[model samples]
Target: MKKIKLIFSFILVLLVAISCTVEGINEDTALLGTESSANLNKIFDISTDNSGKVTITPTADGAVSFKVEYGHGTTSSVTVQPGASTTHVYPEGKYTVKITATSISGATTEQTFPLDVVFRAPENLAVTLNKSIHNLKVKAKADYAKSYLVYFGDVPNEVGTPLATDGEVSHDYAVAGTYNVKVVALSGGVAKTEKTTATIIYNAYGLPITYELATQNYGIGGTFGGISTAVVANPFPTGLNTSATVWKYTKTTGAETWSGSYSPLDSPLDFATGNKIKLLLYATEVGKSLNVELEWAVGGTPANGVAVLKVANTVANSWQELVFDFSTIAAIPANAKFTQLVFRYDDSAKGSGEVIYIDNIRLTN
Candidate 1:
């Protein structure tokens, strides 16, 4: 009975050992027989900031690791695991990319893809030019532009000034004239957009004659009639006429009653707004009459001349503001294009060489 029991136990142990060996062999075979890599694909994300940066993510059906050949003159390839991405920078051109995906069983599949790294030209380019006397300010904006270059056109062979996307550039001309201004927008590559404009640089004489800019041509006109006028330093820079310079009028003895001074404007005045003219005056006596006249240009007939008379009621030897309302005159047309401004003081009366100061001549509603 003891021998039978021992034999049964031995048989059971042998059967158990044989079953474990067979299972181990099957597991090893299964591990070595993994499916080959298939369905190799990739996604590319290219940057728009002109940095030439590209992110590549590779995908495959049974891939455990991937080797990427950027094909842009790179010596070594990039190795990435499944579901991983790699970044590379390339110049503007076309290239081919090679991807090799490997499975757990050491089987690999290779695929090739075409890549294009082209920079598009900038679009919707807008340029603005602001002129103040001889200085010009330039501003530009566009889409897909990395930088800007401005050519003021005043210099020969201009290298152009570098400007940022949200910045402005200014240039001062030595002499006033018309110039062609050019601006170029770059895309960090060979792609570019350009714009050209004819800009006028001059001292524009218009309303609100402040007499501040030294470049302005404040040419005096009209009959002096013994009244001499000059732009001099403000002798009485007090009250409302505290400016650096003022128009001085000296009515000498034996001066005619029509003694006046006039200045020609650059363009015709538009009376679309209300006809009101204001000027700062410093007189020697009160109750003095001042006349403001508007006349046609040299080519126009003198029949369209218009005048408005106002009396000074403020204290003497002090600055005072006087408003001349031409609207009160019904004979003057509303759409008159007046180009000359004439100033007369104490018309139809004799003068004893009294001095008067004038400043801040402007139009108001």
Candidate 2:
């Protein structure tokens, strides 16, 4: 009986040894050899470009897959195969980048690196100014900027105000003068800025017009009949009191008329007496008979009272200021409020392909 008991104990010991060996093989373990540790630092490299784009390249012998996580809120993990690279774009801020490499045996090694991203300057920035009574409406556009800082240049020590892309802001100028405008683009906390200047003028007598104010409630080039008008740099010399740009009209073979219309005046223009219409005109030929007409509204509807005036171009190939006396032209109704202005060339008498320049059309009391 003692011999039988010893045999049973030997069998039990063999079974226990087998169970321990199986458990050791199946347990969760990690593979962190010297080669893997050294490769962990060498396999992963991170870099950023001027536009704040981040790229990560991983290269290791035993690495099977890679996982990268951006530290921002709700950011997802990026996975890539071994010997491959991944890229991501980040805002202007500092972030922690965590990268993990997984082996064939499900062993993972991770490393956290610091990344600093800075914002680039805004691109395609533009500003449009619209003038009104005692104020200027400014609109700005920047395609690449997330936010903006607008400076009206009205007061001192103005830190500026924040705006979004293609936003509009306004400033009130007490009198006519030159003012500075500055715009800044921001991403996260980093900023890049730009600036421009504006000149303001007030006309108290009549509806004022200038190159800068051409787009303010006004329309140009109507019924050209194959004529083209280009807004280009003023070709005239200084002291002509012309704005930076002038309207150059090129007539085609079938060109007949050129007209510019404005929005309805706030109040009816009283042209029954001493008012006159003035404009800067440049012609290529002398003695070109021209007919000028003003169309306006009566009681908020189109009126029949069209003021037609005749003028003779005595100066040839020179810039001259032309003033049409309303009193000398056809009689206008006492209640007529002038709004639209039309200029018709001598279609039957003028040559084809003739060019003319016009600027700064205004009215005077």
Task: List clash counts for every candidate, in order.
Answer: 0, 0
Writing each residue's lDDT as its tens digit, candidate 2 over 76-157 gives 9988887677777666788887878787766678888777777666667777777664577767776556777788777899
Task: For each candidate in the order shown, give its overall lDDT on alpha carbons.
Answer: 0.83, 0.64
For residues 77-100, could you state the per-residue lDDT of candidate 1 as single tens digits? Answer: 999998889999988888899999
What is residue 227's positional error in candidate 2, in angstroms? 15
Off by over 4 Å in 2: 1-38, 41-61, 64-89, 102-108, 132-135, 187-191, 204-268, 271-293, 298-305, 309-333, 340-365
- Which residue pairs show collisions in model 2? none
Q: Which stretches of candidate 1 lie over 4 Å from their true place?
A: 1-35, 47-51, 69-79, 87-89, 203-365
Error of 2 at 108 (Å): 4.6
Candidate 2 RMSD to the correct structure = 8.5
Error of 1 at 87 (Å): 4.1
Query: What TM-score would you give candidate 2 relative to the actual structure?
Result: 0.52
